[model samples]
Target: MGAVATLVAGLGIATATSANAAAGCRVTYANGGQWPGGFTANVTVTNLGDRIDGWRLGWTFASGQAVSQAWNATVTASGTQVTAANVGHNAVLATNGSASFGFNGTWTGSNPAPAAFTLNGVACTGSVGQPSQSPSAPGPGPSASSSPSTPPTTPPPAGDAMAAVAAMQPGWNLGNSLDATGADETSWGNPRITEALLDGIKAQGFKSIRIPVTWGQHQAGAPDYTIDAAYLARVKEVVGWALDDGFYVMVNIHHDSWQWINTMPADRTNVLARYNATWTQLAAAFRDSPAKLVLESVNEPQFTGSSGDAQNATLLNELNTSFRTIVRNSGGGNVTRLLVLPTLHTSADQARLDELTATFTAMNDPNLIATVHYYGYWPFSVNIAGGYRFDATAQKDLTDMFDRISTTFVARGIPVIIGEYGLLGFDRHTGTIEQGEKLKFFELFGAQARANNITTMLWDNGQHFGRTSLQWSDPELIAQIRSSWTTRSGTAASDLVFSARSAAITSKTMTLNLNGTTFTGLRQGSTELVRGTDYTISGDQLTLSAALLTRLSGSRAYGVNATLHVHFSTGVPWRLNLITHDTPVLSAATGTTSAFTIPTTFRGDQLATMEATYADGSNAGPQNWTPFKEFDYTFAPDYTGNVITLKPEFFADVTDGSRVTLKFHFWSGAVVTYYVTKSGTTVTGTLA
Candidate 1:
C-alpha cells in the first residue's frame, strides 16, 4: 500500500427526528487499489428507508485527492466536496437494496480515507470498512505491491476488444507539440508535458489520453530505421504519467509524412520493415505494462499525393494488415494488446470506410479497432466565423456520420473510435459560435458517440486547453464536454431522435407540446433565441412573449419563412415549421466593380424583369441585362441568405459621373427603379 490508508469510523445511531433516521441509510467506503500517486475507491450505499427514488453519495476528501474516472455514478467535485449521483438506471433502490460505485483518484504526498459519507442528503450510519485487496487490481507496475512478471502471451477474451473500446472514456490528444515539424517538441509552442499536466487532465474528468508522437524524424539509418534511444525514453516517461494515474493511454505514430508508406512501390518493402521494427521495439518496452495502455498502428495513413483514391485505400489496408501481423508476432503483451487501425486518410467518407471495414474484417483480429478522424462539415467544426450556429444541417451531418459508423462497424461487433473531433478553438477569434452552440455540439457528439459505442478524442493543439497552467483556457467548454459524458444514460441511436412538426398559432400565446420532457436550447431558423426574451415554457407548454409575437407578425408581413428548432436537455433536436400564408421575398443590391459590397441583409431576390438606360439615353433591353452579365451572386441557402455582385460592364456604363437608371422586378412581386451614379469605378445608387 504505497499511499493507501484504511481509517475506520465508528457507527453512530441517529435520533428518530433526524434526517438520517428517516432515510435509514448506511454506507461502506473501502479502498479498492492504490499506487504511488493515485488510488481507486469503491463506495457501497444501502437504502433501509421506504423506497428511495434517487441517490447521491457525498464525501469530503481528507487529503488533496481528485477523482479521474468513475463508473455506475456521475461524479463531480468542487474543492473537497465530492458528489456521486445515480445514473438513470441506478436511481431506484428498494429497502435493503444497495448500489456500488467506484472512482480512480490522484493524491499528493498522502492518501487519507474519508471519515464520513452521506447518501441522498442523509448521513450514512455504519462503521467505515478497512481497505481491502481489489480482485481487479492492475498487474505489477510502478508502485504495485508485487514484483513484475513476464508479460502475458495469450490473447484476451474474444469480446475484449469491443469491451476495451467501450471502456475508453472521453480522450484528449496531445497534439502539434509532439507531432511538430522538427524533432524538438517545444518548437510547436507548448511547454514540455509534465506529470502535473497529466494529473490535471485526469482531475478534469478525462479518462484517456492519446499521445501522438512522430518518430520518423528521430530515427536513423535506412533499412533498420533505428529509433533514437533518448526519444524512446522520453515517450516512455510521458506515457508513464498517464498510466500511473490509471488513465487509458493510446500512443501512435503521428506526422511521419516522409515515408510514402502507401505509395512509392520501390520503398514499400522498406516501409513495411520500418513499421515492423517500430512496433517491435514499442511492444517490447511496454510488454509488461497494464492493459490500460493501448498501441495505435498509425495515424491517418495516406498515399503521397492521392488521399482518397480507391487504390490508395487498398494500400492503406495492406499497411494496416502488416501492422497487426507485426504487433502480434512481436510476442509479450502484444499478443493481446488492443491495436488501433486507421482508414485511408482516416477519412469519415463512407466508401473509404467501407473499404477499410472489408479489409479489417478479413484480418479477423478481435483486439483490433477501426479509427477515423471526424471534422465533418468543416465550416461548422473548424473555420467557424460570424453568424455561425449549430443548425439543423450541422446536427444531421454529425448524427448521420456517427450512425454510419455504428451500423457499419459497432453493430457488427467491430468498435470504432473518433480518434480526433473538436472545434478549432474556444476563443472568439477561432471559435465564433456562441457558447450555447459549442455546448450543443459537444453534448450531441458525446451522447451519440457513447450510444454508438464510439469513443471521441478531442483534438487540442495546446491553444484551447492550456498544458502548462494545468487549467482549461475555456472552463465552460470543459464543463460542457464533461457534462455530456457524465449525463449520458441510454445506449441507443433512437435515444437521439430528430423530428419536425407544423405548428399552428391562432393568438399571441402559443403552446408547444414537445415530445421530450426537457428543453436545452431553442432556435428560430439559424438564429438562436433567448429563453425569456423570445418565449417562456412550463412543462411542455411553450408560450411566445407578446413582443416576440409582434415581431413574428412583422416577419410574416415581410414574407419571412422560419422554423422553430427545439433541443431537449437530454439530447435530440426537433424542428417545428411555423408555416404562414406569406410569400417569400428576395432582396438585392449592387456594389462598385472595384470592390463589391453586398448588404448583409440581401436575400438574393431573383430578377423578374430588368432594363438599363445608359448615359446616351439609349435603353438596353432585358436581353442585355442578363443576370450573369449584370452581377454575380453567391447564395448560402438557410445560411447567410445571399450576396450580389456588380459586374465590370455595368460599372463602365455609369462611369465618370454618368447616371444609369435600372428597373427591376423581384420574385417577391415587389418592383423598384434605381439610378446609379459612378465616379471612376465606384458606384452609388438611390431609389428613383
Candidate 2:
C-alpha cells in the first residue's frame, strides 16, 4: 500500500440502544488515511455503561466499503455489516474504558465512516464526532488487574559491550514464521514455534535465536498506528521463551524493510511515524526484559525512492538513530539495552561498512553493535552464472567480506554479528548447491566467522531444521557446521569413492582437502584400516587399494556399499562413500510443460550436477547465464522414482520449439547426454 494522500474523518457514529446491552458503547469511526482505491480506518470503542467481557463491536458500512485486513481484532464482513471481535489478550473492556482496532479496506467512489455501531448486538448511541487528534497514541490497554503486575527484573550488566555481543555466537533464525506475511505468523508454511523446537536448536549448540518479524500485517493505521495487543503478546511469549531457556534472542522489523520502510523517501512523514511507533511499542514491551534480548533496528534496511547510495545511507541512518533514541528513552532496562545497527541491506561492502562506521562515530554509544548478512559469493550462493563449485572465487568472497567487517567493526572494539548467513541457493532447495560444495562453503564460513570474532547465525527457513521432527534434514552437514565453530574440519576434493561394477575395480585416488588439518588415518566402523594395505597417502592424494574396494563391494551393489571414515588431527572426520555403479540410462519420454519426467535406470550411478544448453550452444535453463544449470532448480534425479524430473522452472525459460540438450553429471565420473524440446504446452525427451 502506498502513502495515503487523502484523509476523511468523522462520517458518523453508530449508537446502540437496548435493555439487554451489557453496557453502553460509543464508537468513533474515522478514515485515518486513503490512497486511490483503498483506505485505512481506525475504530475506537469506549464502553460507557458498565464493564463487558468478550466484547464484539459491530457496524454497518453505508458506502460499500470492504475490509481486507485487520489488527487487534478478528474482523469479518457479511454484506454491509462488519463485526470486530476481541482477541485473546484483549478480551475485556472496563467501564468507561476504550479498546481500539484498525483495518485496511477498499472503497470505490467515496469513503464515509459507518453511521451506527453496536456492542454485543446491543445498539450504541453516540453523536458523530471527529476522530481523536492523536490517533497514533496507543489506546488504554487492559486494566492494571488484568496486566502483568510487576516488571521483570533487569539482568546485571556485562562488563563490556563488545564482550556482551561476542557471547552470542552460533545463533539460529526462526525464519519464515513470524516474518511471513498473511493472516498470521504461520502464513508461510512453517509450523508454529514451540519450546521443544528451541530446545532442539540449543541441543545443536546454538547460543542465540534471531526472530525476524513482519509487524506491518498486524499493525493498525496512522496516526496511532497501534500494534495488535494479541500479536504483541505472542511475539513477547516467543522471545520470553527463548530468553528463559538461556538463549540470547534478537528481534527486528523484518520484511517491512521492503514493504513500507522502503517508501520513506517518498512518504517520509507516514513512514517515519510508523517506524517510530513500531520501535516505541517494541521498546516499551521489552523494556523490563533481561539484557539477553537484543533489539535490531531493522532487517536489511533499504530505501526505494532514494537518489543513490548517499541518500539511502542517510535514510537508513535516520531509522537507526530513531530506533536507538526510542529504545534508550523508553526507560526500564532499555536505557542500557544493547542495540544492533545495520548497513544498507545489511551488506558488508567496504563503502557500506564505512558509512556505518560514520554512524557509530556520531552515536558514540558503547552499547551499540554492528550487524551484516552473508549469503556467500552471489553466483555460488545461488549456483548461477557458472559458479558451480565452491572454488577460489567463492572462498575469496567469504574471506574478503569477513576481513572488511572485522577491520571495520570487530577490530575497532565494536562487536559485529552476521545476523543471517547461508547459501542463497538453499532457498530453492538445499540441493541447489551441490552437496559436497555446499558442505565446503559451510565449513569454511564457520571457520572464517570464528576467526573474525563475529557472531554468526544460520538462516534456516525450515530447510536446515525439520520443524516437525525436531531434527536436521542433513545430519552430516550440521555436524560439519557445528565442528567448524571451534576447529577446522577435514574435507576432500570429493566425498565419493566410485568403482565401476562393469569393469574390474582399480585403485582410486582422492585429493584430501586438509584445510590446514593433518590427516590421521582411515577407518571402517570401529576397525582401523592398515596403511598401504587399505589406503596410501602420498602428498595430498589419498588412494584406496583395489583389494579393499573389491572387498567392500562384495555383491557390486548399484549404490553405496560401504562407508569409510577419514579422521584428522583436529575437527570432525570426513566420510567417504564406497559406491559401485556403472552408468545411468535415460529413456525417451513425452510430457507437458507443467510436468516432465524422463524415465531413467541409474545402474548404480548418482547424479551430481547438470548442464543444459540450446542447439546453438546457448544456455537453456532458468539460470541462462550458466550452461551448468543449478542442480535441483532445472533438473533433479529421483532414483526411487526411477526418473529424472525436468522442473517447470527450467521449462518456463526455454524458448518454444527449441531443442535443449541436457547433460547429467553423476558422481561416478559419468555424463549422459539427452535432449528435450518444449512445444507450447507439450514437451518431449529423447536419449542423445
Candidate 3:
C-alpha cells in the first residue's frame, strides 16, 4: 500500500519504493526510478514468492527510453520493452514478499511512473524507490560501488567522516586527553587544536559536539561522586561555545565505563546501577541543555569471559537496558535525549549485533539511533609497526563492511551514528599525510554513510588530530587533500592493474573490464581510464601515467614498515597475513615440503594473525602467511596469473633509492624463476 515514487534528493529523508506483486509472488525494487538523461541509479530486486527456479522482471516504459549505467544488478532491454536482473544474490524471495532489483541509470525520455512489471512472469505488488532520490543524481545505489576504483562523483555518496569533516569546522568534544594541569585534565597539546578542529568539524558541514567525561575525578571514594563545580563549569563553557557555533553537542560517561567495558559478570546489576547514577547526576547537570545534546552509554566492553571476546549478546542487552535505565533514573526529558547503543565487538558489524540492531523495536524511543565505531580491519587499521599501506583490499573491506551494516540495520528503520572511525592514533600508516589521509578517510566514510541516510562522527584524538600536527610530523603530500566532503569513488581507470612482467606481455597488450564488459583502457601510450572520454588499447605499455599508473592506488601513503595484507596459498588450503613492509616489491624462492622433516619455522610474522583474502573467509579468498625469518615464506604455485600486488605507500623510498631485494618462499620441488615489472599502481610477476 506504500506509494511508489521515482525519487528525489535530500538529507535525513525517507526513500521511495516501487514494485507490483502477483497471486503467488511479491517483488521489491530499489533505486529503480528511471531518472533523467544526465542521471543514474542503483537498483535491487527481492523475491517474495516461494522457491522455484531463476527470475526475470520485465517492464514497459512510455517510449524513447535510454540507459546510462548500472551495477551489482544487471539489465537487458529490447525496444520499448525492458528487463532487470542481479548476480543471483537473493533470487528466490521467501514467502510473504518478493522483489526484483534496480540500479543507477541516465535516461533521455519521459520518466513517468512506468506500467506494472512482472517478476518471473508474475506481477510485483510491493514498493519501489526503496529510499528517497539520491542527492547525487548519478550516485551508486546500495548495490553498485561494491569495488570502487576511485572517489565518488557526487556529495551524498561520500562517507560520514568526509561529510562531517567537511561540514563541522569548529566541532568540539567536552572530553579530550588528560591535561598536565592536573585536577582531571588531559591534553594533546596546542590550544589551536580545539579551534582548528572546530573549524574543520564545522567545515565538514556538521553542527554537533559530544562531551564525554568520567565523573570519578569528582567522586573519589565510591557512591554518588561529589560533583566538582569547577570541572562542571568548564564542561558547560565548552558546551556553550559549541552551541554558539551552532553545533549539536553529545556528552556522556566515557572512560567511566572502562571498568565496565572489560569483564562484566553474568549479573550486570552493579554496572546498570552505576550507569543510572552517572546519568542521573550528569543529566541534572545539563538538564536545561537544548535539543542538540545526546547521551550515550558505555564504550567498547570486551566482557572478558571465554565466550564474549568483544562483548556478547548478553552484555549488549545490558547496554540497551542501561540506555533505558539511564533515561528513567535521569529525571526530565532524558527519555528524549537521543540515546545511543553499539553493536557487538564494539564496532558496527551488524552481523555481530544479533539483537541490539533491532533494539529500537522493543523500546518506543523515536529519537534513538544505533551508535557504532567502524575502524576498517583492526590489525591493518591499527599499525603494529608504523608504516603500512591501506591498499585496495583494505579499502574494499571497509566499503563492504559499511554495506553490510546498512543492509543489516539502517534499512530496518534504525538510524546509525558512527561515533569513531578514522586512522589509529598509535603507530599507523606512514606514507600517507596524516591530515590528508585523515581527510580522505572521513570523506569516503561520511559519503557512503550518507548514501544510505546514516549519520556519522570521526574520532579525533592525538594521533590523528592536527591544526598543523599530523602533516608536519610526517612527510605528506598535503595539497592533495580536499577540504570538503561530497560523494567519492575509488580511482577506477588509474588503479593500474595490468601484467607488466616480460612473460605476461609477450610483446602483446591487454584489455580491461570496467564493471564486467570489455572497454578500451589504453591507447598508444595512455594508461589511465579517465571519466571524460572513450579508451582503446594499442601498444604494450598500456598508455598510462608514470606517476599515477606506476603502481597500486589506495587511501594514503605511509613510511617504512607500512602494514599490508599478504595473501597466498599454503598447499592443503590457503592462508593470509597482516604484514609490515618498507618496500613494494615481492620475491619468490621455490622449495619442497611434500613431507616435512620437522617444520620448525613459522613462515609468517608471529606478531600477526591470519584470515582469508576474501571476506567470505572460505577458500575463496584464501591466502598464506607465517612468522618472519630469513627463509620464512612458502608459496602456493596453484593459483596462476598469481602475482602479489603491493601498494607503493608500503615502501620506504622506492622512487629514488636503489632497487631493493625482495625475498619470498615458494614451494615447487626445485628452482623456479619469475619475471617482475611495475604497472602504474600495480606490480606484476609471471612464471618465466
TM agreement with the true structure for every prediction: 0.58, 0.76, 0.48
Find the number of clashing residue pairs for candidate 2: 11
Per-residue CA lDDT of model 1 for 1-688, tens digit only, reads: 0011111122111111112223556776756445444466666677776455556677888876877556567566657777776654345666676665656566667888888877655567753232222222111212212212322212234448876766576688988767776757887778888887776665554667899988888887676778889988998898998887557899988877444454534566777777777877777788877777888878888666554476686667777787787777877777888889887778877887798889877888788888998865554654222114566688898988898888888988888888998865332233333344566677778768766778889988886667776555664455445545644311111111111112334433334323233666666534568877787767655655655645554444322344455655432234443323322233444556565533323232333334466657665322243331221111112324343344554454444666766654443344556566667766676656
Candidate 2 residue lDDT tens string, 148-180: 233222222553777676667778999999899
Off by over 4 Å in 1: 1-159, 257-266, 306-308, 383-387, 424-429, 488-515, 519-535, 538-688
Q: Lowest summed-lDDT stretch of 10 residues in model 1?
A: 490-499
Off by over 4 Å in 2: 1-159
Error of 3 at 514 (Å): 7.7
Residue 659 of model 2 has an lDDT of 96
lDDT of each: 0.60, 0.79, 0.40
Candidate 3 regions off by >4 Å?
Answer: 1-183, 187-197, 260-263, 266-269, 306-311, 328-333, 383-396, 425-447, 464-484, 489-542, 545-625, 628-688
Q: How many clashing residue pairs, candidate 1?
A: 1
Task: Look at candidate 1 and give me any clashing residue pairs.
Answer: 586-605
